[model samples]
Target: MNRRTDETRPARSKGREEALDHFVATVAKIDEVLGAIKAANDEHYGTHPDEVHWGHAGDAGRVLAGLKEVLDIIEGE
Candidate 1:
């Protein structure tokens, strides 16, 4: 009889791979959102101070927080 060791084990399950893909895609989207927020801040930094004052930065912060939550969920899995 022959037995397999840890190094000879099969790859991860399909469900796990799918979950990782979903997590990676979500992270990429979060990065895009961050880039957009940074661009908005830069574009309006001097042009419209009122835009940042009117909760644009806060909105961006909220988005970041949501992204963090999603990442945490993925990590927990």
Candidate 2:
């Protein structure tokens, strides 16, 4: 058999492919959970804090949106 060249690596194994599939599924599950959380928060609108407006929670949607974008790039979707 011919040896591998310096520029060419061996083909990926099935195990690696399976692991990648699992990773994609896991990320998707996380996205689902975040969606649920956002929905729940949207449904109730939550109680007001003492003095401050608790602006951080207001940004959850934007934060999750950024994370989804990152995951999209990671999964090449």
Candidate 3:
């Protein structure tokens, strides 16, 4: 008995292939951004402790919150 499912099915249209390709590319871009963020974080945002300010803290806080929201959605929270 053969059962067809998402894994066994092929993309059947040019538009679908394009959409899947775009989704894959967008995920790749997100991965690249995460890598950059990690590197910057390791460098302490390229600043001395005394040089850090409220504006920088706010920027980092916003990014952190955005990432948390994405995680929450993905985790079905």
Candidate 4:
């Protein structure tokens, strides 16, 4: 159908602009999180042989599961 007219174009463009701004902010936040994860990994944040325990494993498992879900969505899986 020919429902969209010139009048709607500006509204759609503004919506797109707002969506893109949100997307950029989200990506920046994700990047910041990834950097934090990398730093934690580099420092072995909770993996010390004497300090590690079942709780650490559980925490890692949950983090991995969450990351896997994000990766699956990013991969269009």
lDDT tens readout by residue for model 4, 1-77: 66898999999999999999999999999999999998987877757779988998888888889999999999999
Candidate 3 per-residue lDDT, tens place, 27-73, comes to 99999999998999898888889899998999889979998999999
Candidate 1, residues 1-77, lDDT tens digits: the string is 79767664545466688899999999899889889868866776445654456476776678679878977996994
Candidate 3 similarity to native, TM-score: 0.68
Candidate 1 accuracy as TM-score: 0.46
Candidate 1: clashing residue pairs, number: 0
Cα shift from native, residue 26, model 1 (Å): 0.6
Residue pairs with backbone overlap in model 2 = none
Stretches off by above 4 angstroms in model 1 are: 1-12, 45-77
Residue range 5-50, candidate 2, lDDT tens digits: 7455434456687899999999899889889878867854454555
Which sequence of candidate numbers ranks them by TM-score, best first? 4, 3, 1, 2
Candidate 2, poorest ten consecutive residues by summed lDDT: 43-52
Candidate 4 TM-score versus the reference: 0.85
Q: Which prediction has more favorable lDDT, 1 or 2?
A: 1
Model 2, runs deviating above 4 Å: 1-12, 45-77
| Candidate number of the best lDDT | 4
Candidate closest to the true structure, highest TM-score: 4
